[model samples]
Target: MRRHRSSREIAAAVFFAGLACATLGGMGQRCLPVAVVGHLCVDLAPRLREAAVLEPGRLFDVGPLGVSLGGCVANTGSRLLELGVDAHLAATVGDDDLAEVVRAAALRSFGERVTLDVEPGAGTSYSVVVEPPGQDRTFWHHSGANDAFTGGTLPPGDVVHVGYPSLLPGLLAKDGTPLLDLLRRASARGSTTSLDLAVVDEKSAAGQRDWADLFARVLPLVDVLSPSLDDLLSALRIDPGTTPRLDLADELAGRLLGWGAAVAVVSAGAEGLVVRTAGRERLERAGSALAPRAEAWAGRRFRRPVIAPRRIVSTNGAGDAATAGLLAAVAAGADPETAALVAVTVAATVIAGDRVTPTLLEDLVTPAPTTPSAPGDPAAGAAPSAPLLLPANQPRGRFYRGGAAIGAFRGTGAAEEFTPEDWVGSVTCVRGEPGIGETSLPDGVRLRDAVAADPEGWLGAAHVAAFGADTKLLVKLLDAGQRLPVHAHPHDDFAQTHCGTAHGKAEAWYILSPGEVWLGLARDLDAETLGRLVTEQDIDTLLGAMHRIPVAAGDRVYVPPGVLHAIGQGILLAEVQEPEDLSILLEWRDFELDGATDGHLDLGFPLALSAVEHSARSREQVEALLTRADDPGPGLPVAAEEYFRLDRHDVRGSAELEAGFAILVVTEGPLEIGGVPAPAGSTLLVAAAAGGLTVRGNGELLACRPPVAR
Candidate 1:
């Protein structure tokens, strides 16, 4: 009978298949796109007919109002497209007469880059600005569809700029929740955003409070916050009149940076603009034109003096134009200083025009060169550079080993030292042995044999011990007679099934002495010979088949599992192995001990025979051991994987082991760890948890640890 598949099995297969497809799909698609949001507005300005005398109840006649595009949506959006950016504008417009006009204008000007969403019954916004004379303009703004704008209208883009939130009352709702949500969505889509502060009606308490809280929530997400000096002063509640006599623009920029802007550019009227980034500020002045021949003859030629335009016609949209120029320059990859210059030039052009005349402004627009000026160039001026800080107590941009710097603070006279407290701990040892006898450590503490202590410290000390926990091989230092048997270990599967253990012994040895060793498959044994000898228990014949090589200090040899090998007498080494003890002894001849039951080896006969790699045991195929003549005795012998790395340090005279906790083993002369005396053959297990202390001693200290794996 056919049965239904279980939900668990079906889900598991589906999840793994989907994950693989997603990983492969992501590897093929990568690109960058930009999104611009905020509603578009039509600005209508009445042409000045006649100057009105200042008197009560007096009305002056004016020409018919002219309609034009306004807001950051029109300026920044159009400028980005003009600069050939892949920028898409997302905004809601009224589905009325004005909407048709606005859509037509945006489509004609922005080509396919403009995206307009029509909201029914919503009137398209239009501001009727009237400037009589010598006074700030009065705006008759009609907020139509923009009042209902929400985060749903914002499209994904590489960069999102919220032009004028003041026009949309919905943006200033409560905590400016809608605006914050839109900006957050853009950020989540990996877009860098900028928010331009709109004009606030500060006469009312509600208006002032709303703007203050709005900027607080807005500025944090903004990467480049370009606010006019006056707007910042209003938002920060700083009284410009009572502040200490200094460059207010520079001070405001500094305050904004401290408040968490990656970069801040403040436009300071006649004083030009101040650009601050990475804790350094620079002043970018307006560019001056060379004096005409007539002016030059009249001694009016100034020496590189930045001058505002000679005539002022219309100042209404000058700031917006300047912002457009700056954004355009940045989108085109201009530096902060160069972008500031371009912005000022654009502002100067606007002031020199009657209306927002694009043709005349373009004629007057002179952009700073794209190429960066060389250092010390007169045009670039001398700006203070931010100091480069280095890691702990070390000199800036310098490499260090011991007794070097740790952390460094730029502009502050503070640095930290790299010491033992900075590291986990160090390793140290005394004598040298290849595998069994020599004492070692995981980090700083001494390694003890399991049989030596009831509660073995080194056995379960590390997060993962070098050897298998169930293995029978006990690491020990032999001062007298102790020869290991010639044996091999079964594979994990075989050992688990027959020997009641889960691991097999695949071990390697690091020779720490000068001694000759016999290793590899039995001597005079081919595949057939070894197989026959293993079944017959011909211990002597098998031992004779193995190869014997002279191994010196700092030599390494690999002994794979199921390979019959043994450490010859007089050889000492450090052994790293899969922690397991099952061994199949193949040799038992000419020893002053019982050969049978009493002193016999457990072969795990059938299991070992099945798991043994006959090809790897050949004499010619066995790898020869490598030894280093010049050994840097255990301190931290480079990081390793097979458990730990061991380092050996040779110290002469009275040496300070710095102020830190370290395990000091007195292999030679007397040494002191943490000021406590440790004589020869004494193992001082220093506690790293105790913090830093002093280690003073006289002798060669061998520091051993697991080898660092690649």
Candidate 2:
């Protein structure tokens, strides 16, 4: 549920931040931006060998000291930007020389994107990190100005991240209200939020506090909660290295999830990490601000092995690297499995290096390893497909609470079953593939590879040549159980220039049920007004500005990028888009989101507001955009043909479907396609090579395919 800004968008935001754009300059042009709130301190590490003994009164000889900007502010924030996230930073620093060094490092790393509040005369906080070779390091830390960072004032972003509450006393005391209030504000503004923790010192003020009461009050406000094992153990006051420590960690993580965290991850050194999720319920709680896909996280319960670094240097900041990587992946629409692996891999890279640098962080942003073979391939130990039936990939999404519409298509009766089972979406996605929105094959086979192994058969030879083995389309059975937030997606140009991605979201919908919806703007509004209303959290004004439309069964709506829209509750539709799950939320109030922190995509309001189409639409414009189902014959309007296409076939007696890489959703039927016995509510992937597959039985189906150009 904790939505993260895409590394691409985050990097773009950082690009502007690094530039220190004075007035939303470059940021106004980007997508989702990320903001990190925490302590920006100096880390002075002095190395010592394990054999060295501490002398009570003697000044022992140690190696040369390594000085750099430490703490999550510099560590995580810098890495996220370096990894190409459009991100910014906010932290409190003392007005000392060390603060200047912190300032220099931050500016040099991310420019004005990082906001450092200098407390006059107060010395910057510092840490004396003592790392004895092969031994756990000890930290002698000074809270300094960091003790006062309660997120009192935060820069704008689509996702807001905070860390080291133990190091921020004012942020943690009184049941962490100040920090919690900030998080609530961020969610109200529609930002997906994340929280990180630091190891607590047994002798410090933090160690003396009652953690049990504090976490219960704060954890639920966070979408993503990642904490180190040491921190969790110390706060819970559990004996160290118990007989069943790993088991205890899992139990602890589950408790936090129960406390309200959507996704709970605990980092255990050497043993790696354990992640838990409540699936459907959690995704629903995240709301539409994040556009979270259910299958990517819901029902995901897994453990990952540590990616050992090439060698051990200092372990400091490695945890931050891990956290940054996972969030980046999540923001980029990468699956949960990929996110965890990337996190561990980045941590490994950090540990293996002498120090974290831009060059090193770049390596952390590489593509994840692809699957070896298609799922269910004989070599993979999964059963082979039975004739015309391909695996029915139905994954839940965070946008809705249940997928009754999707479930009905899959033959799951009246019970609106939703969870690991939410929406039946995607088949050979062209974009955001092998990352997020990809389908798994039989027995763990990946859809990408399955098609790659036989491109001509799966996708047409033309599609393979024009768009490679990947299908240039994505199809989904969307059930709007609730009204989606007023939002818009970026265009290809906007994405390339601001988000650094090849594709932007250009989608169309084929309504399967009746519901009210909002689209486009009723009248042109000045950019300043739009930005002001957004900043002021004027939900009524913003929603009223858009064109409201009443849609019913068989309505075909074309949703171009950069246009504001909201799918009214109770409408079920077959949705198709550019494959990437990228949305810029405009209204988050009354929804489960932090509009102030997440609505702007980290580029600030001015820049993000510019991407929206503020031009007024006439009644004709509205009518042209909406094509009644009765007027069309199995295809979308001209505005959408360039992106994707859809066709509805009501089968009865005998019918044959043309061959092409297509997804067939049984809207209403008890029929067979290409020899596959598909009943009503079943989804099947039909290969182009299947040529004109013979169909038998009476049924209705929605046939989906990529754009004509591909």
Candidate 3:
């Protein structure tokens, strides 16, 4: 998909794009890149009026005829590169004038990374597509050089996608021997094989072949198979137009997976996309070269309609663009759900216009090389810089269960469960400001007062100079014994207008234990719907609008202010955020809190939802917010850096941290600071005057600090 940028923005973007291009160029041309190999065609699409009539052999004036790249290699492959994916195209085109046009476009768009086989005397495939408003499209198609693509020398990559195999006559010959041979060869060549289908003419040699038999043979070697509902029906020798759309797609997807295809993507034109992954056992064995990514794919099935684009226009290459998105994300190592979201979001752009300006899905992309480390023994690395280890400063909350996690850290009694959240070095508190839910330290020595007494000793001199003796950050060790309610936090503007507060809670999560969480709106939720849901206490309706994301230990989640979110059951996490507790809860049933009374922060439902973001965030956008649970170094998402800062200290022998007033949560390993043994399961304080704590032993800790002023 292309990105539309204004002149000034485009010029500025090109600088970064140039940098990205240069970096990607430095990598091997085929390294971890998506290799698209299949049919090549050019589509001539003419838009007709809603009431336009056409007679046989009649030519009339058309509204607008758009000429653009067509077929698998160009549509999907080219779009992949446009979306910032490392992709190389390999397709066969005829030795003709149209071939030169295709070749030039390919070379210009993809640079020298394109691999096209210009066969002398071969016909370049072309299609005359008639798109009339309020009517289905009819195609006058010719499969020329595409029919000659009989699994030619494919490029080397982790994943290889072969599109329109059904349109390639030579590949479908001999009971699909050619296609099987191609897939097998591609697999053996150290590449995971993917397949996409094309609409075949009923009378063509390609359609007359035994597709049912061919699918059995070819699917076993294919790792990913994506076909439209009609295409799947054609393969099954059934009329898809007469069958229920999602049912038929699901049926065919299941059959394809059963036939040993590790993943199945069923496209229902205009309706949406359904993706299913094989079982774990199958993923382990049938994933072929893609097994390393199986954990991200196995045993998942999700269907999503296209995300709404900024505008509605010709849907030419929407599916291909979406496929490009999936492949691009998968190639970049995103999980299945995240990849599917990227697909829908990308496709949304295709439907919206010729180019896509990225919104939410752009967050899924991080530089590939600095990938976070997989979860491991945290104590086996370098120590963080901070020196002092204070005791857990947990304040009681009705729904928190940090006692177990904190107990596990301190090696105390059988670690009874308590809903104690870590609130270290904080200058802000909801109850303290209201003089309710307030507690003091031993002998009425409040932690807030203690910090104020020695601002330079606890908070750094810089922190005191910048914002006075108060620390601006608050951290929590939250154990979600039950799912939290759907809720949102106001932003600074909203809080200032509604709550008389200086800051709003824009929180981020660093998962200490793996589980699921609900984040943002899965669909564009209108204020009426959200307000009604909250007023009526329609829990399902409220939650159904949100995206449920599965997370793992060490994952990072960025929750911007005004975005609705909920912590799922059985998740233990360290939450860092701006120092406030102004929550506007949407779903509070079956929990200890009273929705009618306490859920809305004393503000009525009508006014509270104003603090909620009503915009639609497709599943892809929500998944994009979850970082791949790999990075070990202070892995807070960049989106959250402005609200708060986090550092993951993997201590081996020693390490140094920047001098600051911060809360420390020890996640793993055995370690000590300033001769005090702070093992796993402690939330302590570090004095800024400590001037960077030096770790002496092996352990892992998280340092949570406030936002740096602009």
Candidate 4:
């Protein structure tokens, strides 16, 4: 008679099969996404009354009024997206006529990523800009829906652009729910933020003071803060008269930097611009033609422009355009000098045009190609790459092993198919097994079982002896499978006395294949009701109430001691755990492992009851533990603790390993270990003894370390 496999067996079989397929295939890399906030404002240039006086009854015709979306939501954000950046926009608007106009404009410019937060009866803001020659432009502005903009209207963005600070008074509300507070919240999640101050009148000086304090508070969190010299001096209360002429801009930049900006740029009209770093400043003169003629100066001297533009028109949004250019370059990982150059180029282009488009800018801007070069080259001009360390073939000294073995080599040897029977009887986990041994690990580490001749020498004799006593987690990469039991493990306090162990099981995984995984606290009870569930053998009801999630490869799932969880089919993963095996299985129905009742590992009924989690589960709470590799590239590091520090190292050619003790486990390709070829399934023990090793070759490696406390 043929025997039917248990649910655990079926699940294990499917997992391993899927894992094999993933080993042969590759996953695509992802980039960091971006988001923009604030409302789009249409600036009406010709409608201004000042234009009427300049043109004198000619209907104040100012070059077709140059209609386009402005504000953080449009100008800065749209430019980023057009530069191949993954960007989104979040802005408040009225559901009225202007809302439709702005919404349609945003949709046409940014597509679906633009989110319009609409409030009834609110009107979208608009501005009338008048350039009346020989002075800064005058603005007639209205803050419609913008005045009602609140914290709840904010959206998620990696780098937020808070534009036109004067218009965002609600953002500076004295109440705790300030919009700036919301921005702080977003920035706390690894997002960088920036602010743009508009030209304001002296009459609103008190309002300006409030805005200055707001800037001071938010500036520390901001990566870059760009404001014109005139606007900054007015807001900061710095009297140009009192300040010394020598290094005045440098001093101002230094103060701003001290407030937490990485860098600052001050634009001085006609005098050109000054970019100050932490230690030095670079001044780029205005284009030569724009500079005052030498003969006209009569002993007075003016700086000459480094590069002259072919033509010039309006400088209306030149600063804004330059700001967008600098931000875009920075977002693309360019260096400071390159970013500044890009900014200057962008500003010049905007000055020459009535309006700018992504296509036009892309066509005009030429980015130099970046290439990988040997380390220590000053002109190598690329972001530093990971180091490469070759492990020595011979031991530098005596090798000792007392640390717990987190990973091991399954074996080496190319095989066409993997069977349970073949794996069940294998004594040595090494190369030449019935599994693919050529594929690499997630990081740059290589894999393969230790040879029989060196098993004790490689894994330590003591480690092998304690294999039975120590918790053993078996990971079977699956292509298909049945659902296993929903379960939890006793807490450390309960386990020490009841199970003769101090630690309870807490495991996490990095999924290698995409599929559904069941997880959560088993019982549907609140914290108050948890004690009752534990008193009763309500395993079936508890498992039924837990949450089930469908996950994909490169996704991380964490299971705390009290969370009842089980992985479904089609997943290959690396599981980390505490050194204990105590568990409480809540579901046994449809399970075939060890006759459902006979061979299953079970916690005593009393102890099992004590382990039930009785609080309401939150999706956010769960996701906080699971790191998904949607953006920011493949083989990303998601989880870290003092107990263990884990990172995924993805390499194309070569990468450096930091100078510290870390175990490099190969999750993907054959890696060169100390000039020796080590295939997949091998775990190289990189000790502090290996100090500053170099890793070269293509593939991925998972670097693991003992919990920080150790």
Off by over 4 Å in 2: 1-32, 49-57, 287-291, 354-710
Error of 2 at 188 (Å): 1.3
lDDT against the true structure, each candidate: 0.48, 0.69, 0.68, 0.49
Best-to-worst ranking by lDDT: 2, 3, 4, 1
1-710 per-residue lDDT for model 3 (tens digits):
01123476556457536634643443332224567888888888877766456589877777767777788888897677666655667777898888888887776666655677767798888988877776667778777788777766455445788888878887877777777766754553335678888766677777677777777777877887878887766656686666779877888888888777888988887677888989755654332234544555679888877677787776777778878887776665566777777888888877877664332335654322222223220111111223433334444335434355544434321222344454554545544244322323211234566565665666656667777864677787776766777889999888878888878789999897888888988788788877778888898887887888889988889999999999888787888888787888887666655667766767787887888899988777776677766754456777787778887888889877777767777777556765555656655666565565666678788888876744
Q: Which candidate number has the best TM-score?
A: 2
Which model is ahead, 2 or 3, in terms of lDDT? Answer: 2
- Model 1 is weakest, by summed lDDT over 10 consecutive residues, at 285-294
Candidate 1 vs 2: which has more TM-score: 2
TM per model? 0.41, 0.49, 0.48, 0.47
Task: Encode model 1's per-residue lDDT on 17-80: one tens digit a residue.
Answer: 4533332233221112345666568988887755544588878677777778877678666544
Q: How displaced is residue 443 in candidate 1, in Å? A: 41
TM-score of 1: 0.41
How well is each residue in 1-710 modelled by candidate 4, as lDDT tens digits? 01245476566456534432332222121222456665467777653333245445564344456666776567767655544556667668877897888888877776556767777897888877776554467767777787766545334344556666566666656632465555544443334466666655557633446545555666665556666667677667667886643346556666676665545766655455556543211100000110111122112112212133456666667767767766665444344555666666667766776343344334333332222334321113211122222211111011111101111122211111122111110121221123321211111112222112232332333433543222122222222234444566666666676666646566666675577776774335764454444345465565566676778767866677677676664455655555444556555444433323421234445445566565647766666667786746433234435224556778677777754434455666667655534445444544232345666788877765434322
How would you encode candidate 2's per-residue C-alpha lDDT over 599-693 as one tens digit per residue?
A: 66566777777788999888688778778978846677878888888877867798777767677777777677766656566666666656776
Using lDDT, give the best candidate's number.
2
